[model samples]
Target: MGYNNLCEIGEERIRRAGEKIKSEIEAENAQLTLDSTPKKVPDIGFRVLRVDDSNYEDRRKNVGSYSQADLDFDVDITKSDRSNLDLLFEALPKFQLPYDVRINTLSGDEFDGHTVYSVDDGRLLACFEADIPESLVRAMAAFSPRPSYALVSEHSLPDSAARTNFVEIFKQSADSKTGSTKPYII
Candidate 1:
């Protein structure tokens, strides 16, 4: 009953159930009312499951060792083609989120122009944007309802300084909380 497994299975079941109900309604030839369906429906964030390559890039080398200069060069950890949704699905199971957990995308100005995934109503929040900033990190940490777990891509930050700031922001945010437990960062 890991979170990832549950989210996927639950969503599929829901879709199947919806299809079944729709077909049944169609079979009965029920009169349709304009008010029956709303004009606006939220994005449920469902995708067809398929076999794909790993989200991260394979950097393994057979060489016994590398020089300091060689290691100094930057490397992209994630594959270029992977999307936010891809990362989310890969992370869901690892975090052990519930099957019926709710997921919401927080974006626009409120989230500092970042698309953040709020899982189970802030129990876990994840941002996979490539260009993350201190303001965005702070916003996520200070997000209302206080996420117990926060995930950010290491490659999102601009530099080593930003990376250091990312950890410090979360640390400071956790220190301000009432309990001894701090939110887990990934």
Candidate 2:
């Protein structure tokens, strides 16, 4: 292999190892039947992640120069290269969603105009779409089995009215009447 560093080789090796384990598990699972005693299969998989620079761009190079209010203005909040899976992996721990749980993307009709990913029913909802639509905000506010936590891209939501709608929506969604989504956006 013409690899330069350990990271490259390690990533590839890890990927292959996971594939090997999954195949083994599938082969084992194929043997289970109602007539035969079911054997429990231990979960075997890996989540490979890499470290990088901050996804958000700072207008002022110096953090001291920017105030809390400055973030409200125009600034690219998320890096373009970031994908749904990347955001989902990053947000999973933050939102306290478990790695072992399987996550599925919500059907387009579920949120209509917006892409939604769900984990453990609606315990954690991640909306990674940029330029979130108003319809989505309203739908999320009224979301059934209201999400315990939500994550959105920082600059994805550009409209203040939509944000305000979310505030009201969160208030209504919360069983405690706090109406908060406890949202975390990267």
Candidate 3:
């Protein structure tokens, strides 16, 4: 699918999943508040919900075993309108969302792929697709800080400790090509 199409799909999936979790929480609240259960324990409202790609197996499996991309969705329970339990359920559908990346080269070579990396301190996230040469990889490694994981489209394998360095290098290349200083945040 086209890049725009993929982005749309990802947004829609997140929104739908968010709404579903909201509804479920509302329903449970209504049930617990019924007159028959008036004497039951008080309900604690939800505070936050966090959804990420790793939460879903199908998405992970679809991207292949070596995929390196991940998505994270977070809903604050303390600030959320739903109860604590609602936040829990709201995070469920996030695992089903789809994410992919496509790379193209001046030589017409292409690479397409996806991933589901979870969030962690000091962990760098990256995705690359292109007909990259060893010289370019070396150049990228030269200035960029090394990351914990690297997902290169051409090779379905993830580089655990050197991803950050390459991503920084690739960002520079992309910036130079696009004639812009803003790095692709995704």
Candidate 4:
């Protein structure tokens, strides 16, 4: 509320500015005496609203345009420009995850160098990197606290075998943990 200006910018820049402003306010506050604390900054922040094309490609056709050939093949519904983050956020509301839910970006050698987004402290885990490996799927399944949902883009799997392995790894993980199959969304 103390601020006088607002700017709309790219996601990365906004994130950086938010971090910078938070730190600067904290530093300034730390220097203030008890009496001067009255002049301290108020709770300040920014909300990000991304305006862009839909994450999915439009594959719909008129009733008369639907041909038998269309039924024989698969089509990728995701648009080419959509990033993993875009798809991840788009899925949040569909799953009814809270808007304020915490999302952690995880990437390390342990995850096989793939970026994984841990939602609500691993209650929901999502990875959209291409050519996702079996090891990464297993790692996600083995996440601490055990995610209730494990999500990955269909196109991320290199082949049918990888997709099968992904399901199996999570299924086995659930089975071992609960001594039965648990309802884990994937």
Using TM-score as the measure, which candidate wins? 1
- Over the stretch 81-111, how does candidate 2's per-residue lDDT look in tens digits? 8778776776677766677667868857758
Model 4 steric clash pairs: none
* TM-score of decoy 4: 0.67
- Candidate 3 Cα deviation (angstroms), residue 139: 3.0
- For model 2, state the Cα shift of residue 35 in Å: 2.1
Error of 4 at 163 (Å): 1.7
Highest lDDT scorer: 4
lDDT (Cα, tens digit) per residue for candidate 4, span 11-71? 4566777787778888887788877753455444545755677788667778898777784
Over 34-148, each residue of candidate 3 has an lDDT whose tens digit, in order, gives 4554333333332222443322223323444443333322111123233323322333234322222221221212211222222132122233332344444543223233323
Q: Arrange candidates, best lDDT first.
A: 4, 1, 2, 3
Shift of residue 171 alpha carbon in model 4, Å: 0.7
Residue 173 error, candidate 1, Å: 1.0
TM-scores of all models? 0.68, 0.66, 0.20, 0.67
Sequence-dependent TM-score of model 3: 0.20
Worst 10 residues of 4 by lDDT: 177-186
Rank ordering of all candidates by TM-score, starting from the highest: 1, 4, 2, 3
